[model samples]
Target: MLFGSDPGQAEFDEFVRSRAQALSRTAYLLTGDAHLAEDLLQQALLSAAKAWHRIEGHPEPYVRRILYTQNISWWRRRRFAETPLDAHEATTAAPETGDRDLRLSLEQALAQLTLKQRTILVLRYFEDLTEAQTADMLGLHVGTVKSTGRKALDRLRALAPHLEELIND
Candidate 1:
């Protein structure tokens, strides 16, 4: 059946309408670029739509699992090169807000880390998932999650000591 004609499709559409922004932010954190994040989100949503009947109401976790794994897969394939943000470019692109510099610094620091490290930090701290939950989500061992999270935090601290609350928290 076509979309909008079925109740399941309507539910799915409503979910997307309500959750797209949050999901896009997660995707942007994973990909580090708005355009790439949109692509990643589109790919994940396509997969989710395919399995919509199976997942039904609880699609967030299922979709997030796809985002985490798909990001790792993309890194392994190396479809695009990872580049650190240039200081001038970063400053120029930063929005004119109270914490603009701090946010830009955090973004730059995150860009410096490897994809795995960035993903770990994003999942553990940004998403507020526990080590075990992050490990399960990423198909990693709990110890790996713990060690990686510590290392990622250390790296973040070294990169931007001014953001102590962000790193220590």
Candidate 2:
């Protein structure tokens, strides 16, 4: 119903509610700022709502495409003003365990990545999207997604060697 009075609105709303947490997590990873993530999520939801009538069989892909496009647009508009979280700010939240520290380190390392690289990583890891899915969502070639993912992983490894251990565990 929240998706509008279209035939697929109920199903779409169910899908949105089910995927909201995971999508928010991916958005947080993409933007690194909670506020921006919220904004991105809202924008994506609005766009998805508008298209719900036409996105019956594959709403997930439609919503993901909107989210990715909106994220890239947001990045382009804010590219100049964007800045990485400072070390102090990054560590401000007390980690519950070594694993959390590892996660924080990875987040910090993610902040160092170019926006595109960060986006690719978020789509790949946080969203659990395959390379082809990511490429489709981002309107890029599969090879580009693969290469970007490789480079992003390399940068993460270089920045936080501990992440490998954390990931493995």
Candidate 3:
């Protein structure tokens, strides 16, 4: 049956379950807050549910678009008021000591970036999206994506100088 058919709810639920963790990671990277990430994912899923009939075949891209767009909208609403995680709070669960420190520093650095820059970094690195794919998802040109990625990287470098050492290591 087509996505718009009577059995659409099951398909939609399956899709959400399969993609929830990826979406939550992306949302967490975007918002830098676990609670906000859950809220963002909930909002994106709701929007996706509304458009399920039209997007069933290409669910990943459609859902990613919804996630990115909803994240941007949330940023525009100026509702992000949480304080950034402190150094202690930025710790990760990695077993490798070096990796844990790097992850914490990166998280701290990411939190300092503007919403646009943070989103670009998440799309580029966390989601493993190409510049073109990120541009399409973000409704920006490829050049803009490239430039934003550069700027975001630069800011990250400034915020966490140790990242360069980590990168080199």
Candidate 4:
């Protein structure tokens, strides 16, 4: 029989299929590289699978913790390399176009941040978690989440001033 045919494994498979896109989005925001983000998500899923039996109810929180912590661990080992900006893309004009340019700009901006800072932003903003929830997920004090989130936003403003306007408007 296939592994997923077992009831427990079936549930795990369903969870992965349903949440994979969201997980990949968060991973991409964290790593700023599609390939690396995909790998990160795959690794997190494997890690979660190992503990699937012990995990009761929703496994998303457990998996997300693995994703954030594992990336933090990986970032400690290697330095981040920013993608070279094409000369044309360097000039940030008023975005008269769709979200693609803004997204690219945001992606570039996100890449400039330290791993922990980016992870905090992703958790608080992108993941739509409360400060307290984010703190619990990262094993940080609630104040740390608030402070780090503030610093991360400040850094983002410095990195991508264009995005600030979007926030205001």
Candidate 5:
């Protein structure tokens, strides 16, 4: 039989087909660059594919865990210097028109945060994961997640005051 004929492979394929878009978005949020996000998601999926048969009913959490930890690991190795959004980039955008401006501002604000803070915020807000869930995934204490999330939000507020309303929401 062909590799695709395997039940596990079929299930994995279906899961990817159904969830790739959402997963890709999550990856993009984790990594600011679209190309990096694609690579990150591909790596996570490959890891998942290897363990498909061992995975229980749903594989999203497992894959996401991989994505989250993998991102931290990659960040640690790259140790890229953080750059703040320039005044021109921040002020030139017209926020009144569309989501593009808000998105740019948020991305810039998020970029300013340390990796740990950014990861905490992304998991807490973007993923809608509970503190317990996030802590479990990151192997951090729930209190740590809560405190970091609060600090990240506070820092974001300071960096981009215009995002206050959306941030609170």
Candidate 6:
């Protein structure tokens, strides 16, 4: 069990069952790739399980810290260099609806963002964390959080201008 006795194991399992999907979605936001997100979530959960004894009372923060910090570490070590299909190959794939196309465009735009900008956007908007909370989580000043969030949003807008219609809708 986490940071405690046998009772803590039950609590930890319950927490995982209830929050796994939500946490996975957060991980997906941090990492654009669904496969990587699953791996990231699994690793974070294993790390949390190991420290259950110490973080028994509050495991969420510890797990989230692992998710964020380790994601950065992994990206740094691996250059995020994914190969792209040529236009001919891409267009030859199964046709998608407008909604799917829009989602893909947004995802591509998100991928284009710098790590800092992408992280800030995901932490602030996708995770619905306050600037203060994001600042604390990322170990940045609140001012830095605000500025980065603003800049990230601006860049996202510039990258996917067509999303404005969907946003309004």
**How many pairs collide in each candidate, listed in order?**
0, 0, 0, 0, 0, 6
Which tens-of-lDDT digit does each residue in 1-169 have in candidate 3? 2345568789888988898998888888998878988998888888888878777476877777777898888776774663334445543443335776678777777887778878988888878889998898888899998987898787666556657764321
TM-score of each: 0.83, 0.74, 0.76, 0.80, 0.84, 0.72
Top candidate when judged by TM-score against the true structure: 5
RMSD to the true structure for each prediction, in A, is 3.5, 3.9, 4.8, 3.7, 2.8, 4.7
TM-score of 6: 0.72
lDDT of model number 2: 0.75
Q: Rank the candidates by TM-score, best first.
A: 5, 1, 4, 3, 2, 6
How much is the lDDT of residue 156 in candidate 1? 72
Q: Candidate 1's residue-wise lDDT over 49-92, tens digit each?
A: 87888885578988888898999898767736765544344333
Candidate 5: tens digits of C-alpha lDDT, residues 33-126: 7898999999999999988878897899999989999988887776666554544454434355468878888887787777778888889899
- As for lDDT, the candidate ahead, 1 or 3, is 1
Residue lDDT tens for model 2, 56-77 = 6867667666778888888788
**Cα shift from native, residue 86, model 2 (Å):** 9.9
TM-score of 5: 0.84
Tell me the lDDT of candidate 1: 0.80
Give Cα-based local distance difference scores for all models: 0.80, 0.75, 0.77, 0.79, 0.83, 0.75
Candidate 2 lDDT for residue 46: 83
Once superposed on the true structure, which residue ranges of model 3 sit more than 4 Å away at CA? 1-5, 79-96, 165-169
Runs off by more than 4 Å, candidate 5: 1-5, 79-94
Which candidate number maximizes lDDT?
5
Indicate whether candidate 1 or candidate 3 has the larger TM-score: 1
Task: Kindly list the per-residue Cα lDDT of model 6 for residues 1-169, writing each as its tens digit.
Answer: 3445577689789889988988897788788779989999999998888877788566787888889887777766664664333333322233256987977876776776666667778887777788898888878899998887787677666666667664321
Model 3 global lDDT (CA atoms, 0 to 1): 0.77
